[model samples]
Target: MPLTFTPHPFHPADMPPVTLITDETDDVELARAAHRSANPARGRIAVDPTPATLTSAFLARDILAALGRTAYAPTRAPVITAAPAWRAVACWFIVDGIRELTVLRAHLLTPERAEQLSVLRELTGIRLILLAAPSSATQAARLGTCLAETGLTDGLLRLTADDARAFFTRSLPTTTPLCPTFPLSAAPVSSQPGAARSQYRAGQLAACTWLARHRRATGQVPAQRDLELFLSRLTCLSPDPATTLARIRGAQGGFTAEGLRLSVPHALATAQGPGLSTLPFTARTAHHISRAVPGPPQLAALASLLFTGAHLDRLVQARVDDIDPDGRFLALPQPESAEFDHHNPPPPAWYAVPPSARPFLRAARMFRQLEQVPGHFHLFSKSFGYRLEALVKDAGHLIPALSHLHPGPAWHHQARLTHR
Candidate 1:
């Protein structure tokens, strides 16, 4: 799929020629042909083949980086100096709304991050995109609030199926049309409606696979509502499933009566599980975590449980001041706010140091050297639990007793058991 950016608002008189940024090499050729053929006055349109996330900061850095490589003279418009690799065959950049790229308000961008973009914009003269999809009225309101323009909204043209198809064909001459004879299905019936929706793109691939298999077995495409239900359920894993479904439904604008069939790429369409290693935890499993974990942070974090029954978050947030090195004791912090989980409130203010103090001290000493007043430091990274869980899974293969523990539950169970 082509790397698509949200359209920005701009005036024709002030607008610079459109530049397509993509990680796909083939897209470079396609975009070049299309843009040049469409308008010679548009000047030389450059299709950047870089793989950086199209955030304001990253794009600003990329634009500045590209300035050093090309012989092109610097102009008022920003220049890209570095670009990331993309696997896309063809991508596009449109002249419409080309000046200020818009970020979907539904993403719930933090105010701090938005201010950072404002700083970058002042430095680079590149306006950050702040548009939301028109399908969402609430999002539109939120976007207005973010921009301090509550009255502003861009009207979206709802195109007919034929109009969309015509636009698509004219827009990219290089795109090969999916042949009608292809035994492809767009949406699939999910066997596990109750199953937690995986990732967005993952669910789409799975749904497509299910649709293809169903067609092969029953010789009929599923109803539209069925597809909608599958997507609604599948997208529940996302922050806004309703918005996600609306986006998906909006993309289905061109689906014909026969159903919109697509060629599923090999890598993405392949069925895969959560890819976590599985095994139950035993004392031996705990030992594996201790050994497999190669850092003081992880070791110190795990060893803390041996001395005190603190929860994972509490132990990680412990600071140097919380430790009484000479007294052979540790103090867990109280919750800063009353909004603690009812089931797992704050631990006691103090805990006796365990026999594993040698390594804990080593870890603590190392942490102090890094930063003297390291307040509320973490021993293990956010992902450490998953890594430890995976280690337990790998250990299960060799140790028969650990084989019964499923990695998902086993990880949580071990975490809960830390308090005991």
Candidate 2:
């Protein structure tokens, strides 16, 4: 599995074994040796094909092993294959961004496997390099047939030993290393005089704002997922709030520029008024949410409340599929069920999610998805009733003005998680 550089069969209609790359002495190991010089990081992978099983599933798994995806992850897990084997193979080629795929044993391929590879190449636009000499006349005939089935002409650029040597002049190191000194956030990031922040800047400005405030709130570098989720949330927000935008830009500047840590600009410092030490109402609420928000459903509901323009009742009906792919809008009634006509279809209700609040909504969506909740399932039904009192207590503690001290029989303004 760890990149050891190292075959398949045929039917008639087989073209003569198309010459791929051949060494001077006809040694297959020599043919496979070039993989040592291939750079997997740069989207080039040379596979040692495990072609013994001869089934399509086995071929698909062989390709995956070469691409380094024989592992489970939220995005790349292959167990729940979204497509059939050959299609999955093609899909992963795109997902992993592969440009060149080198297979070590060209002579061993079956017509079926050759067809799969050729189809994959067609679908993904990946360059296929077949190596190894057909060790016998039978293998040579079969390989020719395989190549014909592959739908590639014998004209595939044939590199001689000298050319192959020229191509793989050097080997790349096996792994990439990470740098730790990369900026995470800045609570006391040293401020500096620079060109003034442009008022026109938007998304990056929002990112910096979140990072600056996050550092102020937590007093340390964010966890990796937290930073990624924070950026993702900022992507969801509206740009009208210039204060948030400017702060976000400052945070970005820290990462891009050499010396500037993500401190708020003097313009925002003066305009937004006092800093976190003064304990502004929103800041206090942020603290409470950090410490006491019940869970994803409650937190997401509170986040949506800030900018969604929808009431608690509307949000209570939110389903896992409500939000758009970009995480910016939550469409009420769901887009699929919304009316569309020939002339001008009436648009469904578009509820906006501030980029700053998208992470909360995303967390809630993920929570629902993990439980295998269907698209139409309500997000809040399970958690709301039992946790309602605790949430109301927290809400009131954070913002007494908007919250009711006593509860009603059904969910109401007083019972909502608005303060978070």
Candidate 3:
């Protein structure tokens, strides 16, 4: 439903009947003309023609003085709360019985700021939105026309529950991804350059190392979820799980039974090093993995695998059957259920070895291995695909068009480069 405002109740005495003047020579017009004629004393002004002088504060002050006097008024202006920059000039038109003021305010506006103004107008029922922006006169004039056509001052506002759903429904493009990028493999700690020591890079390095070690130990791949948790822990940055998963899917690489692998560009690999690795992973503090990895798609994929594995291991060990469809899965509380405590977690779920879940389990174990051996020469991209398929089998139903979107090496590289 269109949003409407209930006008405040008005006693008959609160509002006076608007006076109408049919003739052009009305008192208001006469008053304005008389005021203008009386103020016709000419003032000579000189200005330096140089570029520096043109932008000088003194010149700006003089210009403001001249403009201000010409547009001066004796009447007190009404106060507007949360007025958008573009609407500052049009406030007079929005307020009933105030159109004769002819007062104009100088301001600037940008396209993004203008959109913000529109959104504010929709959210608030205020008319005569006055803004103070530094936009060009032509741009302001165009915006004024847009305001009028859109009825931004007078029309009912539109509201929606979920902006994302609304956007897709209306065929609006979603925001561009902003995930971080890093090198393909965890670089050696001793070989780190000054720039590589950034908190982000450090986290990526730690995550990569963790994944590589896990892969080597388990002879399997890691899932996207596993990578996500690993990175999150290393960086101490947490992103929405669903959103992170989506970005991982969009990033280049795939999960496999052997390890999480990302296809690194020949250029990047040559420039940085072979098989990037992250931090040394320990089971005791594995929960620290939640930081995001920044890099090309392949790096992003590896990071996702590392971080997500850490998170899933904890979650799975906490309550095994929570995700299992069959009734065979069991929940074992920590410090209470010795069967799945720190010393001994329930043997991998029965389904872990089955055709349906075996691939995912293998990927998970590979991520664990990567954590153990931070230095290893592995086929990064091939590992990524294998892990990706496993994650799809486990959680593909949670996303839209999971089967249709296939991320390429270029896409991964572009995702990393642009994001970084």
lDDT of 1 by residue, 1-420 (tens): 111122222332333221212111223333333333232112111123235343443433322222211212222212222211010000011211122332222124334434443332332223233312233557445534643331112232233333423433454433332211323432322323522343334545655665667678877665433443333233322222233333333323222222664221133112111111111222332344443332334345554543333444455566655655342555555554465654776443444443334334344434343332344464343324455454333223242212323212111111110001
Candidate number that wins on lDDT, 1 or 2: 2
Give the alpha carbon lDDT tens digit for every residue of 1-420 in model 2: 111100012222332333377553566545545666556557777777664666555666656555543412212112322124344355345534677777776667777778777656655567677775666778777876768766765456677766676666544446533211333433321132321254224444654565578669996665533543443244223223343444356445544443234333344322211111011223334334523342445656655544433334455667778775445656543122235554554333444455445555655665455445677898654434445455555544432212322211111111111111
The digit string of per-residue lDDT tens for model 3 on 36-153 reads: 3211112111111123321222222222222221112212211112221122212211221121111112122233433433432332222222322224667556645544454342
Candidate numbers sorted by TM-score from highest down: 2, 1, 3
Supply the TM-score for candidate 3: 0.18
The models' CA-based lDDT, in order, is 0.33, 0.48, 0.27
Q: Model 1 off-target regions past 4 Å?
A: 1-290, 336-348, 371-373, 379-385, 391-420
Question: lDDT-based ranking, best first?
Answer: 2, 1, 3
The runs of at least 3 residues in candidate 2 whose Cα sits more than 4 Å from the true structure, single-residue gaps closed, are 1-19, 23-32, 71-83, 160-162, 170-232, 235-420
At residue 245, candidate 3 shows an lDDT of 27
Question: Pick by TM-score: which candidate is best?
Answer: 2
Candidate 2, run of 10 with poorest lDDT = 410-419
